[model samples]
Target chain A: MTRSAVSHADLTTLSAHKVRAAIREGAYGGHTAGLAAGKLQCNLAILPERYALDFLRFCQRNPKPCPIVGVSDTGNPHLPTLGSNIDIRTDVSKYRVFRNGALSEEISDISQVWADDLVTVALGCSFTFENALLRHQIPVRHIEDGKNVPMFRTNIDLVPAGQFSGKMVVTMRPIPQAQVAQAKEISSRFPQAHGAPIATGDPAQIGIADLSRPDWGDGVQIREGEVPVYWACGVTPQNVLLDAGLPLCITHSPGHMLIADVAEDAETTILTTP
Target chain B: MTRSAVSHADLTTLSAHKVRAAIREGAYGGHTAGLAAGKLQCNLAILPERYALDFLRFCQRNPKPCPIVGVSDTGNPHLPTLGSNIDIRTDVSKYRVFRNGALSEEISDISQVWADDLVTVALGCSFTFENALLRHQIPVRHIEDGKNVPMFRTNIDLVPAGQFSGKMVVTMRPIPQAQVAQAKEISSRFPQAHGAPIATGDPAQIGIADLSRPDWGDGVQIREGEVPVYWACGVTPQNVLLDAGLPLCITHSPGHMLIADVAEDAETTILTTP
Candidate 1:
């Protein structure tokens, strides 16, 4: 099916499992931006079991950017805690293959690359809170502009664990000055989804020299009366792993995530608010 | 000073540092039961640096039992995050020395046993939440009975990390049927202090065959119209360390804790309700 044809369906009508199945069977291979509405979707990170402990520490130390939702048992592609019959190797519509820290391939299935020594980590994504924001009638600039949220590397250093160490990367959103407090209260409820803004107003306070240039994603225009708010981004782990020059790493490609059986609202209340 | 003289002089009036000073100077060695009222008191764990990372992982995996209040920089003995001027070796009123996982001595000061490779971990104690429970009018059976809270070993296996792994340990408190909900809500707010009860009624559900036979502390009577509630106990780490058969380890004797500068209320709000 064409990408445009796939995008036309009312996502509100389908369940998360059905959407994931479509993605798994090559019936769909596109950005999951607005698909599987009201379901928890996550950023995927699959690595060797040897590095799992340290990675878990890294996430614990830096919960804002790496709020872990579910960690698959070693070598098991199914995350029983996340959803029944959800296969990590095939659930995500697209996977970025990295070998020795370099981009090796982008494919629909990693069943060929799957190993008994591998471990999968599912991290909460900002999209969870973005839905919360929209629910509260807060306008998200990037989504309205039909572009990815702009992300930047900051001077803030992540708490290192073993071989994983790097600076924090954050995503930017523009909120009206009057609505900033509401934005914070709404977002803070989603701790699993990066929680509240790390910094607002002056980008330079967090070491960003230019708001126009972002390290990842397309930058959105910051209009008058709107203040730029920043949040810890999920892209952080992938970036850190790449920086560490690990021999192998696998992650879901940007905008293509693993949709879980967990209801978005249920997960939002459990993870974000708690 | 006599214990009677010290007990009457507003024992809860002093700061954590002053309280420790009195203990260190041999002026006070009685149970730290009502001292430093609102401060965060901790269960102490000291081990060689080689075991630090594994223990950290163990704590991470079993957060309910070992909610870390502070971890000293290796061999530093000073816990800066917990409090300024807090010296792990001297601040705790009493210390239990263990050699090859066996009890060696209970001393007032461990300055002589201090080592460059030792790492000190300050874990949250139930005292913080016990105060909350009492304030909310929930009867704490053990406290009213003038006994240590009954603790038991459960069939639930803790997530093992490295060499540390064992069954979970729990502390029991009997609450009136009507007050059980309030007790859970209040205690759940203090995740650092063992958080909410792990099991409410039948101890058998968590693998405890008898209510009278406790692994540690004094067992209290469960009266009519009351239910026994269990919270993960701080003694879990100590028990696990002993089971690991480490060459050396040290902990605060039961009821003798290291008082911290963090307010009890702050810790309560930080974990449960956050």
Candidate 2:
């Protein structure tokens, strides 16, 4: 097949606002890893008001995997706090719709099926801290190899909230033994971005039975003398939400996130509004 | 008037479990400030399931003032996470019942009023860090003067969530100008206990106009060379809940609290389950 002439990759200099605008208008629908440069990108979750409280509590109890950056008001889709012109229904490049614990559809926009009672939740994504890691000379294995970061279901049980309960999910990165401390220190400063590594050195202790296979995302090679460092992944919430079998739920397609205007360093606390 | 011979003061040496047992049996119905010496004491808020979500969100957003230590399962009064045999309906020395947001009754226990729909919320109290401050020889003005800590409603707006919105409420402690940094450093370790000072020096920045008066609790004298340090108070959730005018709500009476089995230092995070 011939390569497409117009693509998100070609617009390297586009601002974060412009990227969001392009996604909103269906101009670009691919992954958004490097689209917005220094801005914070967020994982999106939308659900009905009836389940909003339990979901919010789930995030609160499990901050490691579900650090909430922005929560929309009940029945409101506008996340004005995260971005000046965010419409949850159409802001993301792609959305995975879930119904009764099953993936029902994959679409670029939900404006056609939008409801008045929906509440949107935005969680801090690791992409923010990954940028920080690179700037500090701490290499992220998957990013360097041009593949999705390996994510595994762990044995660490999440502190349950209402009907939301599950073990935590973690993402792994191969870091040189010497740079372990430095990488951990740099990432620890961004609490919104999952913070420091939850586990280092051993994968068996966290219940990852295999290195090459991951529950989500693709695995990368661990070079000689490098140790696997794990940080809580944002996928835990989406998985828990799906397992609850709610009547309706929506989430950003993996890697397709909502780009916020806030700089990565500007976001310090969770649950703060505009 | 002369005070009664038998009082909570005599139960100083009692274990936290024993103290709770006595409170449960209606043996002691006074303040809980000095009891349970090394254990954690908590502020209680009980509401119907319908209001639990919004209330929890309110706490999550305003963690400084409303740090939650334990949240009960819906329709359950047992806070086993805080204590092995804790019964939320009867654990505290005194209970204040509110209906339609108005004070309705003051009771020794809520066993009769307890409903299957009630969800209990436990907030971290200042008593934990005050004990730490005292151990470090940092003088607490209210303690030295033998009066209640001064509390004021600040102009700092709380991050609102679902019908729950209000200004922050803070407790003022007078500290020597030289020890302000030390006090902040020590208190910051206990995020569950409202953490470090939110405001120092002029009260006007946080909306307080006078040091001589307080919205709640008695005001104490600020000696020369001392500055007032304010901390987010546990009273915030109670105040906001009342203001929301819910159909039903219950809280620990002023100064009366739930004495938990957990040690003050054992608690590190907020919103653990019970």
Among these predictions, the greatest lDDT belongs to: 2
Query: Taking candidate 2, what TM-score does its chain B reach relative to the real chain B?
Result: 0.95
- For each candidate in the order shown, give its overall lDDT on alpha carbons: 0.81, 0.84
> Interface RMSD of every candidate?
5.9, 3.7
Candidate 1, A129-182: lDDT as tens digits: 899999888999999998989999999888676688898899999999999999
lDDT of 2 at A262: 76
Clashes of 2: 0
State the C-alpha RMSD over the true interface residues for candidate 2, after superposing those residues. 3.7
Classify candidate 1 by CAPRI docking class.
incorrect
Across B126-186, the per-residue lDDT of candidate 2 in tens digits comes to 9999999999999998888789988999998887888999998999999999999999988
Worst 10 residues of 2 chain B by lDDT: B265-274
RMSD of each: 5.6, 4.5
Highest TM-score, which number? 2
TM-score of 2: 0.85
lDDT of 1 by residue, B144-181 (tens): 98899899999888867678989889998889999999
- Candidate 2 lDDT by residue in tens digits, A1-274: 1223348666568887777777777778889998879888998889998888778767766777988777787778786667777788887989999999999999999997788888888899999889988998888989988999999999988878778999999999999999999998888767678878888988899899998899989989999989999999999999999999999999999999989887887623432455
